[model samples]
Target: MKNKSIQIQEKHHKDLQKLSESLGQSYGKLVEKMILYFKRTGIDPDDLKNESPSHKIQQLDKRLVSFLKVQERDILKPLRQETYEYYQNYDKTLKDAKANINKNLGLLDNNSEIRANHILKELAKQRKALITLSEHLDPANKKGLKTVFQNIFKNAN
Candidate 1:
């Protein structure tokens, strides 16, 4: 590359020289790197001349916060609302299913009680029939049959 010169203040040149020495780089190399950095970052050198580094950082922070707020408004809020609605529907469905199950269990308990009552009624009828049959038998056989029937009824109770 051909060597070129540009006019700058003596104080700025001295400052650049001091920075170059501190960074252990040649003055020309430091200038080249600064130009490359500005191009790569898409920041104008003229704008940098007017703003301090802290001011630039503060502006970037504000822009980032604004962008995040916009994202929350556009994306996160709707998703959270949708999730809440889904959970509400799911909870309602679960409650309905639980109620149905409880109703069915109540029906089963009622049915079991009815069946148990029917069985006890049939056993009572059979015991009465056996007692009448024993009275028609001979005394010796009637006594043995009476004891057996009594034992059977006792165990059933």
Candidate 2:
């Protein structure tokens, strides 16, 4: 391995030495590790001079929150409203259909009751006429068959 020297402030040199000893690494190894860290993270060393790490993290958190808010406003809020309106319209349509069906059923019930009553009256009249005809045709009747036939002919005239 070849050794190299670079000029730096005394304070920075002492700080680097203290950090190296605390980390249990040689001075050269510590510097190599620091270079590798910056390279892997793709961070500009000059950018760290203006802002602390905590400040950068806070900025990222704020950006993420704003992005979420925008998504909610642009996409989720409208979707939620549309879903609510669709359900409301569906509920109204269902209620209207149910009312129409109930009204039709009521009309059908009334019409059927009236028609059944009229049919029953017609059937009763027919039954009465059949009973009268059967009694006249009966052999046991005191009025003979000849008398019944003569009466039928007279009525026809």
Candidate 3:
């Protein structure tokens, strides 16, 4: 005669298990051990790992990622790129600006007054975006986020 058993793992988060090698089994088998233990005993498997606020911090850290993404059309990216390229182009005006202001500058054709105005406008908008991003990365907000991330990425090493 033989008996059949039903395995039901409840109140478990699966990833919270901790074990070492030399247990003579793969990760799947370790998970099975957790499942078996939970099923046999009325214990929650998730009570093992550190489910710290680190998860929330990881989510919050990506908030500034979009700011970093800013494309060519992006106000900050274009402005910065245009400003850098403007001075990089070899020309008298840029050379003079570099000498006088100690910073290289680029000069567009005077004939394309409309294009010049558009470029200047875009540069201004980019400056605004940079300012906004800077403010957001201020110490106050960073401190709050740091507290949350301490669990995940603290300087332990």
Candidate 4:
């Protein structure tokens, strides 16, 4: 048997209790998952480690929203460069469909594309984050983080 020690905040006590009951698993088991995940990967698991969903965390998330936006820009760089070359090679006859999308739909004006790109980028970003968070969390924590993201995203819409 493996026994692990974890620090849980009282602020999340209610949520922990609720989860303990809903999952029919002890809080320890839940935390175990996060621990193992972090050990295997180098991502920070504590990114989701919050005792409460306070206004401060929300504000920080607001900032992360921009960071992800920047990352999305970075992700598109290679694609954009290649597309630009292709356009140049075609003498402007062929247009980049994604650029056309940006123009015709006005998606970027509303941050929809940016948000969508962030989500797409999160797939890769979260891996490292999950691994890191795992150091402070476990499988249970990973699920909790996923749940947080789900709730945050669901509420955004």
Task: Give the runs in model 4 whose Cα sits over 4 Å from its true position.
Answer: 1-7, 48-157
Worst 10 residues of 1 by lDDT: 134-143
lDDT of 3 by residue, 25-64 (tens): 6666676686897788656656775444677577677765
lDDT value, candidate 3, whole model: 0.60
lDDT of each: 0.87, 0.84, 0.60, 0.72
In terms of lDDT, the poorest run of 10 residues in model 3 is: 11-20
Best by lDDT: 1
Q: What is the lDDT of residue 89 in candidate 1?
A: 100
Candidate 3 clash pair list: 75-126, 86-106
Which RMSD values do the candidates have, in order?
A: 12.8, 16.9, 29.1, 37.8
TM-score list, all predictions: 0.45, 0.58, 0.23, 0.24
Q: What TM-score does candidate 3 get on C-alpha atoms?
A: 0.23
